[model samples]
Target: MRSLTESDIRTSFVNCSKGEAQRLSVPRDLGQLPWADLDFLGWRDPGAPDRSCLVAEWRGGLLGVTLRFPPSRRGLRHRSMCSLCLTTHPGGGVSLMTARKAGAAGREGNSVGLYLCTDLACSLYVRGRKVPESGGRLEESLTLDQQIARTTGHLSAFLDKLYA
Candidate 1:
């Protein structure tokens, strides 16, 4: 991944109107981001909690998506999972990430919430940021290579849909 600018981020959006893309907030320190370590760049708008965005390169072109996160029920138990890494968390380190639909139809429809790792570090997880318990062993159900592939696949699919 390469560092991006606000212009790069906005231009990456394929689904949204040009006006919408121009208005969306882009990260200020895109140049400083650890691009090699990021499968995608995801961030919430500081001015609008319900609004968020993600940017990545897929298939040869840059892609980006706008998202919305509806407020959750307070005090309700969460079977938390990270959407980016698909990792389950017992009670902590998880968040709901929802993609806003493109066009008017999306605005009138309900948003979708995806459980995502709170830290939002899918790259780190894929690269073995830390042992996933069980004495630093990979899960028996999945080989280490499979895990990395799955993570990157998920990210690529998300970007594809955004640009499609």
Candidate 2:
């Protein structure tokens, strides 16, 4: 994935009003991100723990989505797999994130949800740069590049649903 600028990210959002996109926070350390290794960029909002953002190179350009999740339930710990990267996590590490559907459907309160890494670090986990809190990723016969492709494919499918 190519490195993105703040303006690029803010303008790429398809599901939110321009004002909301402008108000959303972009990562402060964009310059330090591992762009070459990323299939997409995702992060949780530091100021608003329930809010998260994701940006990816889709079709010919960038696509951004805003996501929300309920507050974590304290003392709940169980293993769950992230649908995007297939990494398993315990407790609050995985969240059921919901993104408002694009345009009119979103205005009608329609949304799409998926189990995802609470930290929004699927790219890092798939590449072995970050480890899950519980057991590691399942052993796979596919090569590292193949694993990366599978992860990206999952993400693309989810994005496709947004436009459906």
TM-score of each: 0.72, 0.96
lDDT of 2 by residue, 1-164 (tens): 99999999999999999999999989999999999989999998887878999999998999999999998773546677899898888888889999999989989999999999999889898889988875789898999998999988999999988988
Q: Which portions of model 2 show Cα errors greater than 4 Å?
A: 74-77
- Looking at candidate 1, the ten consecutive residues that score lowest on lDDT are 130-139
Candidate topping TM-score: 2
Per-residue lDDT value at 141 in model 2: 91
Question: In order, what lDDT does every prediction score?
Answer: 0.66, 0.90
Candidate 2 steric clashes: 0
Clashing pairs in 2: none
